[model samples]
Each structure stands twice: as C-alpha cells, then as structure tokens.
Target: MFHFRRSTAVACLALAPLVAQAQINVDSISQDALVSTPESVDCTLTDGSTATCLEITVKYVPENLEVGPFCPAMIDDIGGIWDWDGDEAGLYRIDAAFLTMLDEMGYHFYDEDGTVHVFDIRVEGPTDDNECISGSFDEAVEMTMLIPTTPVMADAPVSLGTVAKVGVSLSGVPVFADAPSALDTGHMPALDVCAGHVDPGGWYHYHGTATDLDTVYDHAGVEGSCANAIQDAKVQFGYAFDGFAIMGSLEHDGSVPRDLDECGGHVDGDTYHYHASEEFPNLPTCLVGLQAEDNYSTNAAGGIGAEGKGPGGQGGRPDFAAMAEALGVDEQLLARTLEEAGGPQADLAAVAAVLGVDEDALRAALPQRP
Candidate 1:
C-alpha cells in the first residue's frame, strides 16, 4: 500500500543489481532489547509473494536508556532539540532562544514570564494551535515487527515518507522517517539530544537514526550526541523492512560513497544496501525494495495497539466520535476525514474543507488547547 515515489527529499539513484543475499543472524541483537524470542514465520512479501521472515518483538522504550526531557516546562529550561524550518533555520537546541524564535514566527510555545506550552498528544489527540507535542510513557506498549529473511527489490523504491515506519535501531528504539514538519503541521515534535521523541502512543521512536547522531550532528553542526559509541559508517545500524542492512553516510573505506541511488542505496560488491544521509534527520528516505504486508503492530496487556497506525503512528487514541457528536457530524465521517488528512496530526484546514464546516468551529470543537 505504501509503494510510490517520495517527494525528492533524498536523492534517488538508479537501480542496482539484485544480488543474492544471506539472512542476518537474529542473535546479533541483544536479548534484553527483545520482548520474546525471535521466530521464523511465513509472511507475504510486498510483491504478493510469500517469504520467510524473522519476527521480533520489543518494548516501547529501549531496555535501560533514559528517554525524554522533550518539551520544556519554561523557555529557559533545557528541553530537547528540534530542526527549526523557520527563519534562522537548522537543527537547534530547544532553549529559550528557540522558543523565542518560535513565538516570533507565530508559534506561541511560550507565554509572558516564559512558561512553555506543551500537551500530551497521546491523551488529547492533536491540537489546532502551534505548540510543542509531547506525551507520557506507557510501559505496557510493545511492538512486533517482521523483517523478510531476504529482500526482493520492488518495482520502485518504497518511500519512507512522513512519520512512516523506517526500522528499529540497535538500541531497540523504532526509527522513523523525518517527522511531520512543524512548518507544515503547526506542531513541533521536540526530539531529545539523540534526535528521538515519544510517539502519540507513548512509545519512544527516532525521527533520525539517533544511533549515529554523532555523525549527523557533526555534519549539520548540531551540538548533540548519542549514547552509543560511534560506529564506522559501513557498520549496519539496523535492517530495513525489506531485510537490507541500513548503514551510515560513508562507505567501508571511510569516504562518502559515490554510487548512492535515489533511495541513497547502491551496490557495494555483492551487497546492495541503503545509506543514511549526514544531514538533519539522517535517515534513508526510501527503500530500494518491497516490504511485507501487515509488517508491524503494537500491543499492550492483551489488546492490540492502534488498528491502522504504523510503527511511528501507534497507541490508538479514542476517536473523535464524541467530538463529532458534539459538532453534529456523523462519527464515521469525521473519523474517515481525519484519517485521510493524517490523524493525530490531521490538518484542520483539510478537515474543515471535507466536513463543510468552518475551520474555527472545528478547532473550537477539538479538545481545548493547553
């Protein structure tokens, strides 16, 4: 369902030969990072073919690492970091100056005397105003993912666009495509120093490949670092859904590779794989191959997580049924409208257009902003 051309964010390269590949040893991942034993399961490939896959389940947060400090309580308080797309743009620390700049840009994440505005997108769904998006941690959340034992190059590169599911890092944290832009959505998902943030479902995930943040930070001139030791760019940080290794910005020889294709992928001898960019949100924006259908899901206690949400878009929230009823709109109609507009971060303008309601009224009907 996700096969297509991503807006030319990451350069796409010409196709490489689909060479024979071997299965990654599931044991290479730490046992603590996993919630259950890895199992070989029959799965449907993206090309409507069946293939064997390794199913791995992990906790919402990584085993022992500290997470957050996202969304500052006050402008002066040190929070996390954000890739500012406004004037004076670049990756920056979420400090007083950042909040001040946001306020100037019509994003009022702070008030007089400097208390910063923040809300749990998990409980409150999305807000209509420009504010910092944050959420509480839910210990019950767990994710199960499938990695095709061997990848098959797709008809076209699968775009890992939006906050789409990218892959899981070595630390067990889920990696995601670049965040939904604050410039585009009026919501700033403040990422920690390692370029990660909590999802609306209360699970922590990366907007960038935080495992290699040191390299990305150096390239973007952001003063941030990751907890893991900097690995060689050639070392595979993790595996994409297509079952190919994901590496950093350089080749095994410590030089920038010259053969990267549109998906930032190229053949390095027998292995055809993808590379992460050195820029902000240092991730491969597309996959060179197909991924399995129903590739991942979130679950807690005994119930499933979000129904249709991806790895980055999990922890189902109570829908807008009540809100729709309050506004005298059909519940299913409102739900479908928001889903198409990007639920949890659905653009209100689009919702108003679809529902034939005034944008201001829809905003007023949403859970009042903090």
Candidate 2:
C-alpha cells in the first residue's frame, strides 16, 4: 500500500503562508539560474483542460550541472556505475548478486554504446484550472519503464511505469519518473546516490529528489556533502510539465505542509503546487494539474527525434568524434573514458576523474541527454 507522512496541526500552521497573494509569478522563473533562454508561447488547451495557458522553452544540460564532486564508482562487470543509495542513507553498489536479484524481480539494464543525448526542454502552463488531471501512472510515455512494486494511492493509482522525462530540477537536470526503464540491465540506470543517473543516450537525469542525500548521515554521525550543497532554499526545486512549481518537503518557514492531495499537492489560497517527499517516490505520486504535450524533445545529436530516429539513426551507435566535439573533450579522452567505464554505461564521476577533470566541467562539456 502507498504510505504518506501526514503533518500535525502545529506543522501545518507553521507552513501556512503568512499572506495570500495573486497567482504564482511565472515570470519569476527567469530568476532561477538553472533556467535559461525562456521564451513564451500561447497555447489553446483542449480536452476540457483550461483556457488561459502559456508555454515556454528553455535550454539546459540533463545532469545537475551546478553542485558536485560527483564520484560515480564503476561496478565490476555490472554494465554501469553505482551511484544511488537504495536504502536512503548511503550509496549502494550493485554487485552480481544484486543484479541477479533485480533481474529475478523483473528489473533489467542494458549495455551502453558510447553516446550522449541532450535536448531543449519546453515547459508550459500555470493556467488557472484548479481541476486535477487524472491518468494512469502505468502508462509508458517516453521509454518502456518497469512497474514499480511500491503501492500508490491517487485518483488513478497504478503500478509505477518508466517515464523518460518527468520534470526538470533546479540544477537543470531532467527529473524522470521514479522507476527504471526496462531497457536498462545495469545495476541502476539513471539513478545515483544524489537521486539521479545517466540515461543510455548518455544524458544524466534524476529519478527522485535531487537533495535526498542532504539529510543522509554517515558512520561518524555528521551531515553529508549533499547537505552543504544547498545553493538555495529547497522551497522551489523545479517545475512540472503542467507549469506548477515543484517544492521540497519543507515550506518557506521550514515546516512540512499538511493536507497534500493524493498527487502530493495542496492549495495555499490561490496558489496550487506539488511537494517532494523524503521517502520513496520522492516526487509527486501523480500530476494534480493538466499537462501539456511536446514539453520534451530530443536533438538529432543522439536523441530520438520526431521520426523516432536516434543517434546514428535506426538502432545505431552515435558518432563518437561528433559527440566528443560537442562535449568539448578530447576525442581520445572521451573514447578512453567510455572504454574504461563501459561505453555508454560510463559513470560521469569515474570517467571525469580518470580524465583529470572535475565532474562539473565534464558535464558542462557534454551534450544534453535525450
């Protein structure tokens, strides 16, 4: 069954806004350093959605290009690196036994082919429609995702299916739905200790909250680096496809909000928004507002385009030299990094270190993951 941490009366009062305001300022989005080249579009929402709506396009790298000291360690024989903490406390390295168990459980990973994918993500809305949009979480959108074993309660609760692109993070990485795709056979595809991982197309994305490791405690009983990596208040991490802001577990006053709906959302007077949790399925269990189409797309560099063609076209490898040039790294270094880290299954932190560069630099130099 799905589980949620309900807030007490005191906590709710602490999180309530001190003053009610007009609609959320979509223009304020430009203030976020992670968002760039914001352009507006007028959209007519059909299917009984809403009337007043706006769409915007922004350019960003797929990974958290801001904070780091990424150290994705290579797992021997396991196609990809181990970067995520399965237990929420520390990192878990997927070994042969773990892989075997996951495989038995019906989860799989695929071999990498030494290519990176990137894209210009489009976001829209904040349309005054308060009506919640309903859809099955099991429906596959981008990639064929595995159904998560975890139970969820919503307007239409269903097994967790893979979502290629869910939302965008404040650090500029794409937040994928909270399950691994069936196409992956590595230990954990696109999931790392920081709650993010690289996709097969060579783009890094998040599957959960970006700050999950912030509250992590090690053997010494001290706060982890993730805690110190808070560049801004966790109030607003990113935006969902529907155009509503995705906040963290805490409120502006540092307290959890009560009365979250089944979709992990609640209304504060006029403003409606979603919240990230501290537990499994760290993001909203489902979208409470209407979502727009064509919010996400891949570039011809390595992503699947309108014609359903990716990288080298139909099921082909990407151009290594072109990818290296786009990433601004030496072709030889890029090739060696892929070879050592296992082709497209390369670990950013491990590969970056091997090439004598920082993770941020390497990520900045790379193309966007599709």
Candidate 3:
C-alpha cells in the first residue's frame, strides 16, 4: 500500500483574510436528499453574535443511491471496509482473515464455528463487548442542520475531532470527520465500498469526501471505490461547518493542489475554501470559521441537541449532566474524558479509574439502556 506524505511545498494552515462567502442556494441541494424545502432563519453564532442560517432537513440517502454489503456472512468472505490504524495500518477489506488477525490479538469478531458476529446496533442497541455494527435505515427521523448564510472566520483555527461534523454534501447527506474507531470502541461500524455508513441514528453520512476515493484506493491498494462520488475533479464536493466550500481531491486541471493549509484550505479566487485529500478522513482537518450554534440536530432520540452541540451520542447514551452530577465530577471534565475514551460507549472501568471512582458505582450512575 502506498503511504501518504505531505509535500513541504504545501502552505501551513494560517488565518487568512475573510472573503465574502456566498449563501447556500437551495437549488444546489439534490432534490432526493431533502425531506423538506430549506428555510432561512435567524440564528446565533458560536461567538454569541447574531446571524442568519439555512435550516436544512435531509432524508436517509440520496434518490436511488444504493450502498453496502457490510458485515460478511462468513469469515473468508469480504464484507465492507475499515481505515485500520493498527496491525498494518491501511485500508483493509473486512474478510475472515482480517477478523482472524484481530481475533488472534484477542479482539474476537467471530464464534468458534467461524460465524462472524453482526448486529444492527441501531435497533438492538449498543453492547458491552465488541461486535460488528451496521445501522438500519430510518425514514421517520429527520436531522436538521444550520449553517451561517455567511461564514465568520475564527480568530484561530480549531482541529476537527472525531465525528468532526464537517458539513453537508450536495446530495444533502452529512459529511463527518472520522468514523468511530474500532480500535477504541471494540465495536466496528463497517463502511461500505465508498467509505460511508449509517450512523446509529439511521442517517447516512460520509467519513471522507466520497469523491475521488480512487486516488486513496489506488494508493492503499484497496479494491473497491465510492458509489456516488463526484467524478469531476474540479467540482465542489460540499460545504464545511463554517460555510466554506469543500472541493474534490483535484483541481480543475485534474492536478492536486500544492498550497493547501493545515485545514485543507486555500484561497480560491475571492473566497477561501477547503479541498479533499486522496486519503482516509479526506475531509477538512479543521474549521477556519465560526459556525452557527446548535448547527446540527434531529428529532430522533439518539439525535444531537437543538440549542447547540447536541448530546453528541447515540440513543440510550447516558445524559452528561446527570451522569456528571451522580459521579461528583466536573461536567466539562467528564465530557472530555468520555470523548477521549471513544465516545458514549467508552470503557467504564477505565473511566472510573480516571475519575477515582469504583467501576460498579460509575456503571450504576449511568442510565441503564434497554
């Protein structure tokens, strides 16, 4: 597999002068992606300033878009894909050999009869131990996203972390930072050929810019590719939380941009925008502007919040405020610890030790999931 290396010629990320960004015209959104027509409304920025934003509610997948074959039936059969960071550390096909390799290292993904453990965690709920989870689709739930009509550049750029919430694609699907780590959660949410999966909330999202995955696939020697990615290298892929446009991996000339900043951003004419890389987690590395408060949300139980920054967890997730109060710890501290521990289903014993509490007590303090 080809290893990724940054060209030193690429400009390091630095604050650039803010250029006026155009408002997202509803026409740009694919008709199939929307559950309802977008609405422009007043909103608050993260900086406590007032701004207008476009409220967009999306459907599960784009019109006629098909994906999957995740979670193989047998150990030897190839199922989906994972951007593995350990044991070889490259894109891998989820076959029996891959599971066996992990199982040998004690991350059992199969039974003695070689039957791979598969679950629709969204329906069955999260587990205490590792299992391969592929979410089921839900049409009843709708996620509403708010992006400032005009982005406000931040005083300083911020790193995009796990599930970084990059922005929405042309198809109206959400584009995220990184998928939950199999290494961290013990559970694996296998991505289909295009490096996308159903979130536990039942919405479809991309962890990487599905466009131009071929570059990464070829580099990593991976066999499959994205199903609905824009093949036009120069075309815009999506928008970032900050409202900057995200381009496909290549320039209009079908050449890689050499001067991208740390956030994958560079000046494009009058506006500053980001570009996708031909690598895993191909979205922007950081946010260059201030986005709307409560930028993402859903009516679904596992949904993010309405006011801002949501619950940031799946359904049956423990309430942060209640758990923190019960644990007698700082809320911010507890939140950061759990995020660091790999999201909501973080290791309880490990978290207990960090908080200096008994594991059983911590578990009891957490809301019991059905």
In terms of lDDT, the best-performing candidate is 3
Model 2 ranges with Cα > 4 A deviation: 1-36, 46-56, 60-160, 181-187, 216-234, 300-370
lDDT of 3 at 301: 47
Candidate 3 per-residue C-alpha lDDT over 132-170 given as tens digits, one digit per residue, 9 for 90 to 100? 877787777677899887877887776766665789988
Task: List the candidates' TM-scores in order.
Answer: 0.81, 0.50, 0.87
What's model 1's overall lDDT? 0.72
Ranking by lDDT: 3, 1, 2
TM-score-better candidate, 2 vs 3: 3
After superposing candidate 1 on the true structure, give the runs of residues whose Cα lies further than 4 Å from its correct spot.
1-13, 125-128, 228-234, 300-305, 308-342, 345-347, 351-370
How do the residues 1-370 of candidate 1 rate in per-residue lDDT, one tens digit apiece?
2111236455444665457776757886667578988889999987899999989898878777777788889888988888876678788888987787778877887778887778776666544477788877788888888888887777677766556778777666677777666765667778888778876666777777665677777877766667643445667677877888888777767778886777777887777877888877778878877788888787632112356442225443544777787778998677655543445656777678768788898887765433
Per-residue lDDT tens digits for candidate 2, residues 202-251, read 34456666654343323223323343225333568766655557787777
User: Can you give the lDDT of residue 348 in candidate 2?
Assistant: 62
| Steric clash pairs (candidate 1) | 11-262, 12-261, 12-262, 13-261, 13-262
What order do candidates take by TM-score, descending? Answer: 3, 1, 2
lDDT of 2: 0.42
